[model samples]
Structure formats: C-alpha cells, structure tokens
Target: MNQAVGVVLLSHSEELASGAAELVAQIGAVNVPVAVAGGDAKGGLGTSYHRIQEALEAADRGVGLVVPPDLGSAVLMTRTVLEDHPHHDAVIVDAPFVEGAIAAAVAAAGGADLATVLASAEKARSVRKF
Candidate 1:
C-alpha cells in the first residue's frame, strides 16, 4: 500500500488551520491527512507537539510542516517539538502562508513528492498576477 503523505499547518489561530484544511478538502484528496497546530503558547508547546506527533505518526511515510510568514515565536515552538521527537518521520518545510496551503492541497491530490510539492508551491507563489 502507498503510505500516506500528510500536511501540518502551524498558525496563530485555528482559523488558519481550518482555512488550509478547507483548501485541501476542496482539492478532494481524502487519502492524505491534514492537521493544524495553532496557538501553542496557550497550552505550551507540549500540547501542540503531542497533537503534531499523532498526525505525523498517522502519516506513516512522512509529513510536511507549514509555517506562516513572520511567525516569530511559533517557529521556536515547532522546532522544539521537532528536536524532541527526532524519531518521528517528518520533514519541515518553510511555506509561504497563502501559497503553502494551496500548494499542499494540490500536491497531495496530485500525489506529488515532497520536493515536487514544494517546487509547485514556489511556482504558485512566483506566478502572482499582482
């Protein structure tokens, strides 16, 4: 069986996660799991790490962790989680906030590899009309 490739979005609010989830859902790839880790400060990174851990474990093959732009402390929080759980099979990707989620969804549906997914994301970002 093909292992599942999941997406994890770390944001300042649950709404950001939900928006990403909605985009992925719209793309119609139900096989890959999509999760969101928001506002880690409230419950501490431990809570967020646990949440991310479960998502990563379920992913089996690997996961792409997305971060928003200008997210100062959240980056630290996520890094701590990554360091504490090196055994977890996942890769961290620095994704542009808007394009990242859309790219993730499109890639997941297209069954593209992580590098391809990331490339696609960059392309999408670069091709802005504005």
Candidate 2:
C-alpha cells in the first residue's frame, strides 16, 4: 500500500500548530498523517528543537515528510533536526504556514509523491488574497 506523504506543522504557538492540523483534517477526507510541533515543553511562545524532532519522527511513515514552519526560529530548528536526523526525503517548505500546511495536506491526501507534496506547499507562496 502506498503511504500518503506526512505533514509537520511547526509554530511558536501550540494553538497555531494544532489549529492548522485541525484545519487540514477538515479540508480533506484522506488519511494523511498530520503532526504538530509547537512551543517548548513549558508551553511558551518559542520553538522547541526537541518537540520538532519528536514531531518529525512521529510523522514520518517511510513515504516522506513535509514541514511548514511558522517563524524564523521554527524554521531554523526544523533545519537543524533535518540535518541531524538526516531524513533525505523530508523537506522544509518555505511557504506560509497555514496555507502551506493546507495545500500539502490536500496533495498528500491525494497520494501525491514527496516532490509533489513539497511543490504543493511551495505553491502556496503564489496564492494572493484580494
């Protein structure tokens, strides 16, 4: 069976990451794995390297992993995890957090490949609100 691409949402606020995961679940009826790593163990407004690592490990299902970070530190932490853990198929997308998560989830739900899922997240950069 083909596993759907996994998604990891990183944010400084636990609410933001969890909310985005909920939104992604609501947007599609697919069984893609959606994980959230937000804030530190103390539940403060900052990225947690440990939390991000845990999320990545939990979300990865041998298919692939896509991460959308909410802030600069979140991105940095994600990068550090990727480098240290060395999940070659995993990618940290440079796109709007919420939008990218939504897009990536939809694509993953459709059984899109890792590259396609990453592209879907990156495509969110072009979305314009008028």
Candidate 3:
C-alpha cells in the first residue's frame, strides 16, 4: 500500500486545531500524520506563520499534505508559507475545516494518493448536514 497522505490544520484557536486532530485519531486515523498549526506566536487568537511552517515540515512524510485552514487569514498565512517552500509536497485545499481534516485523514489512512486525498478533503465543502 502507498504511504498515507498527511493533514495540517490551520486555525486561530489552538484548542480547535487540537480537538480536530484528536477527532481524526478517535476516528481511527492513528497512522495518518495529523498536525495542528494554531494561534500566533503569543498564543493568541491568530494564525502563526512559524507554526504553519513547522506543522508542514513535521507532518509531511514524503508523500504529500492537505492543509485545511479555519479562517481567511489562516489561508493567507499558509499561502505565504507554501510560496516560500515550493518544494514541499503540499496543497491548500479550500474545504470545511473540521470536515475536510477528517475526510483527508480517513482517505489517507485508506492509502489514497495525494490527489485523491486532496479530493476527499475538498469534497467536504459540499456536505449537507440537514
């Protein structure tokens, strides 16, 4: 089986990021590399570039990474980091934060490729909970 893709969640709140990662684990994605990049350097309610960079570096296992950002600024910070590190096999998938992270983890645990894993996360954007 192919190596599992990784997930990096960017959130303004550390608890939110950690909780989502915990959910991924609780759902049996123990093998998936799930990293959380939340809060700012001061640990306040803001995204941190350093945290995002560290998370991407730590989560990547030579396969790829699907990053889901919680807020608009989180996306901007992640984009800047991605631009600086073009060599990293990662992509910013515009998807629902928690839903996308869970989907990505499940797909990756099932041995899906980078593209397929990314697709799984992106598909969460259309999920209807009604």
Candidate 4:
C-alpha cells in the first residue's frame, strides 16, 4: 500500500508545535504522519537543526514530507537540514503554520500524494480568516 504524505510543524516553541499537532488530530487527521519539530537542545524556545532532522526522520515514510515553519528562523533551520538530505522527497512550504499543518495533515490522512499534499498546504495561505 502506498504511504500517506507526512507533515512536520517547525516552530520555535515546543509547546506551540505540539499544540498545533494536537489540533490537527482534533480535526480528524488520523493515521497521518505528523511530527513536531520545535525548541532547541536545552528545551527552550528556539529552532534547532537537530530537532528538525529528527522530525523529518519520524514523519517520512518513503512518500514525501511537508514542513510548515512557524517563523523565519525555523524556516532557515529546516532549509539547512533539508540541504543535507539532498535526495529526500520533501519541501518547506511558505504557508500559515497552523492552517497549513491542518490542511496538509488532513490531505495526507486521506491518502493524497506528494503533489496534492503540497498544493493543499500552500492553498492554506489563502484561507479566509474574516
């Protein structure tokens, strides 16, 4: 069976990242590979290359990975980690962190492929909040 796409939430705060992941679960994104990459090695508020790498490994299932970074620093860290993994099927999408994570997680849970999942995440950038 084809594996579902994975979604990673990269944030500066561990609590924020985990809370977002929990929200995805509450939204019925069951069985999807959702990983949280947040905080530094000391468990404080900061992005870490190591944490991002760990999240990538845990989420990836040979299908693809969609990471939505919560801030600029997280984005940079994710990018640096991804650079080392040249052959990995992954992408750092420029989208709203929570909204994109929920969208991507739902799509992945529905067994969508990489392209579809990627598009779904980016589409969250247009999500209406009004």
Best by lDDT: 3
Local accuracy by lDDT, each model: 0.59, 0.90, 0.91, 0.89
State residue 62's C-alpha deviation in candidate 4, in Å.
0.5
- Structural similarity to truth (TM-score) of each candidate: 0.73, 0.95, 0.95, 0.94
TM-score of 2: 0.95
lDDT of 4 by residue, 10-129 (tens): 999999999999999899887888899989989999988888899999998989999999988887778788889652789898889999898899899888998899999999999899
Number of backbone collisions per candidate: 0, 0, 0, 0
Tens digits of per-residue lDDT for model 3, 25-106: 9999998998999899899999888999999988988999999999888989998988987636799989999999999999
- Record all residue pairs in model 2 with backbone atoms less than 3 Å apart, i.e. clashing: none
TM-score of 1: 0.73
Point out where model 4 deviates above 4 Å: none
Residue range 21-110, candidate 1, lDDT tens digits: 777777785766676665444644323656555544544455453333215555666667678776354555555765776776577667
Q: Clash pairs of candidate 3?
A: none
State in Å the error of residue 9, model 1: 1.1
- Indicate the residue-level lDDT of 47 in model 4: 84
Flag the better candidate by lDDT, 1 or 2.
2
Model 2 ranges off by over 4 Å: none
